[model samples]
Target chain A: AQSVTQLDSQVPVFEEAPVELRCNYSSSVSVYLFWYVQYPNQGLQLLLKYLSGSTLVKGINGFEAEFNKSQTSFHLRKPSVHISDTAEYFCAVSDRNSGYALNFGKGTSLLVTP
Target chain B: DTAVSQTPKYLVTQMGNDKSIKCEQNLGHDTMYWYKQDSKKFLKIMFSYNNKELIINETVPNRFSPKSPDKAHLNLHINSLELGDSAVYFCASVDRTNNSPLHFGNGTRLTVT
Candidate 1:
């Protein structure tokens, strides 16, 4: 079984401040990692994904994440945050051996204040 | 154009009632799924269908049933809905490939009163 852990439930940061949302996962086999953002009353939008290749992955809205294999972590980061970036972020993982069922973390609510 | 769309974005009904949420995907994807997000914002997979065939069915109660008449449409029907059945149900679709990201609908917020 594969599971994802989002370390923080809520993160408040001032606008233009750098922020990081931590995520960790455990799986018996190789897994695909993804980050999705959900605005208020909206559905999830893909932010980034780590299938293979480079450990560092860039995504929309100037967000990025690094996949750490040894530590089993994939943390999302942004040099500067905007008030519009406030949303609920979810980290999900899918076992490569299995089908398309994605195991998702509880979620991290990012509240950016202006 | 909307990639994935679900009807009745907000649903409020009495307990023990029966209701259905309809979902359609225009992305021509062969695989679709139903996910439920509870009040705490935890998203869990309930059912998945690929090429109109049931592929993944989680430990969901028999009260919840998913039907796919075709690859482009997947609908969910709940029987004898209880108070605990209230949650935001999201419909999503993805390509046949495993690496493709899911395209999600706005979601149907079901409130059991």
Candidate 2:
């Protein structure tokens, strides 16, 4: 079975400050990684994904993530965040072979303050 | 237009009662999925259908059943609802061939009394 671990339960940062949300996964075989964001009372939206491609993947809203194979990590980062960026973020992993169902992390709540 | 839509955005019902949540997708995707988001905001996959056929069925209780009328619609029917079932249910669609991203609906929040 595959599992995802989001180290930070919640991260608080001031507006315009850079932010990083850590994520790690455990899988026996090749895996696909994804990041999703859910705003207040809204559904989850895909932020970015990493399949069999470049290690650095860029997403909408100026967010990006790098897939580290050796560390088994796919951490989401943003050069700077705005108050509108406040939302709950989730990291998920799916097996490359099967890739049937995604295994999600507990989630990291990003709180951006003015 | 909403890419994915679920009816009864908020459902408040009594325990042991029966209820159903309908989901439809307009993206012409062949794969649809149901996911549950608990109070803590952790999303878990409940079921998935591909071309109206069951594909991924999680360890959900027997009381929960998913019916797909066609490739564009997937409905979830819950019997004898429990307090533990009070959560946000999200419907998503994806195109497996393109390895496309999953598009999610605004989720139906079900509250049990």
Candidate 3:
């Protein structure tokens, strides 16, 4: 079974400040990692994914994540955040063991203040 | 055009009632899924359909049933809804052939009163 852990429940930052959201996973098999952003009253949108090859994955909206195999972690980071960036972020994992199932983390709420 | 769309973005009904949420995908994906987000913002997969075939159940309560009449439509029907059933139901679709990212609908917020 694959389980995802989002270290922080909520993160507060001023506009233009760098932000990082930590995520960790536990799985015995190789898995696909993904980051999704959910705006208020909107559905979750894919930010980026780490399938294979590169450890550093860049996504839309100037967000990027580094996948570390040794640490079993995929942390999302942005050089700077905007007030529009405030949203709920989720880390998800999908492995061969769990067919068609994306195990999602509890989610980290990002509050970008001006 | 919306890649994934679900009807009745907001639903409020009394307990013990029966309701259904409709979903459709224009992405021409063969696989679709239903995910539930609880009040705490935790997401869990409830059902997945591939090529109109039921692929995963995920230990979801039998009260929830998924029906796919075609490749692009998957509808969820809940029987005997309870207060605990109040949550956001998101429908997503993906092309399993190349492992594409899942496209999600706006979601239906169901509130059981």
Candidate 4:
């Protein structure tokens, strides 16, 4: 079975500061990586996805993530964050051969303060 | 219009009662799924349907049943709901062929008291 691990449970940063949420996955075969964000009282939304070809994937809200196959990591990063960027971010992985059911990690809470 | 929509955005009911949450997707995706978000903010897949056929059924309790009338709609019915069943349930859909991104509904917050 595949699983995702998010090292940071909570990350606090000031507005306009850069942020990075670390994510690592364990899988036996090729995998697809994704990042989803959930705002307060709302459902999860796709931030970005890495299917193939590109190692660096850019997402909405000026966020981006790089897929490192050797390290088994897909860490989400943003050069600068706004207060509106504060939310819970989840890292997920799906085996290429398996169905579309995603394996999500325990979300990382991003708190951006002014 | 909402890409994915679930009825009764907030449902509060007593324990032992039965309730159903209806979900519909306008994106015309062939795959739909039900995910449960617990208090700890862990999202787990409960059920998945492809073209109105059950594809993946996780180790969820039998009390939680999912029915897909067609490729565009999937509904979840819970029997004898318990306190542990109180959480946010999300309905999502995806285009199976392209490995498209999953589109999620706003979610239905079910509270059992």
Candidate 5:
């Protein structure tokens, strides 16, 4: 089984400030990791993913995440957050051999204040 | 154009009533999935279909059923609604591979009173 853990439930940061959201995972087998962002009343949009090869992955909206195999972590970071970046983010994992189900974390709400 | 779309963005129904949610994806992905998000923001996979074949069916109640007319559309039908069913349902699609990210539709909020 693959499970994702997002520690913070809510994160409030001022506009233009840097922010980082931590995510960890536990899997009995190799897994693929992903980060998705959901705006208010909107569906989720993929922010980025870490499949293989690169440890640091860049995504849309200037956000990025680094995959740490030793730590079993994939933490998302943005140098400067915009007010429009305020949204709820989810960390998800899928076992490479487990068919089609994706295990998602209880989302982390990010509030970008001006 | 919307890659994924779902009908009835907001649904308000009484308990014991039956309701259905429709989903379609224009992205032409062969695999589609249904996920539920509760009030606490926990997302759980309910069903998945690939090439109009059921691939993954979670431990969901028998009251919830999923039907795929084709590779591009998947609909969810609920037999008898309960207050616990008041949550957001999201439909997503992928290319039926391991590396691709899933595209999601704007969810349908079902409120069973």
Candidate 6:
């Protein structure tokens, strides 16, 4: 079984400020990583994914994540964020062991202020 | 058009009542799943179906059953609902053929009183 741990449960930042949401995972074998965002009263949307390619993966809304195999981390980062970026972000992992079903982390709430 | 859609966006029922949530996907994907989101925003996979066949069934109780008449539709029926069952249920689909990302529906908020 695989597990995801989001170091920070809540992140508060101001508009135009850079932010990084930390995520770490533990798995016996190589795995695929993903970040999904959920706005208020909405479904989860894929932000980015790392699938055996370049360590740095770019996603929508100018968001990006880097897969560090040694550290077992795939943290999401944005150079500058907007107010609309406030949402709950989740880090998920998947592999053949779990039949490719994504195992999601608890989630981190990102609150962007004016 | 919505890729994945579920009906009864908001369901409020009393305990011991039975309710059903219907889900459909037009993406022609071969796999569909049911996920539960708790108040704290944690998500847990409940069930998954592929090509109208039940593929994955988590440790969920038998009181909760998932029926897939076809590959494009999956419905969840909860019998004898409890207060603990109050949460948002999301229906998602994915193209298992190619390692595509999962597409999710808006979700159905189930409120048990």
Model 4 local distance difference test score = 0.95
Model 3 collision count = 0
Model 5, A44-97: lDDT tens per residue? 989999888999999999999999999999999999999999999999988655
DockQ of 1: 0.82
Across A1-114, the per-residue lDDT of candidate 6 in tens digits comes to 799999999999999999999999999988989999999999999999998879999999999999999999999999999999999999999887876778899999999999
* Candidates, DockQ: 0.82, 0.72, 0.82, 0.88, 0.84, 0.79
Docking class of 3: high
DockQ of 3: 0.82
Error of 5 at B51 (Å): 1.5
Worst 10 residues of 2 chain B by lDDT: B94-103
- TM per candidate, chain B: 0.98, 0.99, 0.99, 0.99, 0.97, 0.99
Top DockQ hit: 4
Please state the error at residue B97 of candidate 5 in Å: 3.5
Candidate 5, residues B27-109: lDDT per residue as tens digits?
87889999999998889999999999998999999999999999999999998899999999999998865458888989999
lDDT (Cα, tens digit) per residue for candidate 2, span B2-93: 99999989999999999999999999999999999999998999998989989888899999999999999999999999999999999999
lDDT of 4 by residue, B1-113 (tens): 99999999999999999999999999989999999999999999999999999989999999999999899999999999999999999999999788898899999999999
Tens-digit lDDT track for model 3 on B1-113?
A: 99999999999999999999999999999999999999998999999999999998888778999999998999999999999999999999988878787889999999999
Evaluation by DockQ, superior candidate among 1 and 6: 1
Determine which window of 10 residues in candidate 5 chain B has minimal summed lDDT. Answer: B94-103
Candidate 3 global TM-score: 0.98
Choose 2 or 3, whichever is better by DockQ. Answer: 3
Better by lDDT, candidate 2 or 1:
1
Q: What is the interface RMSD of candidate 4, in Å?
A: 0.7
The TM-score of the first chain in every model comes to 0.98, 0.96, 0.99, 0.97, 0.96, 0.99
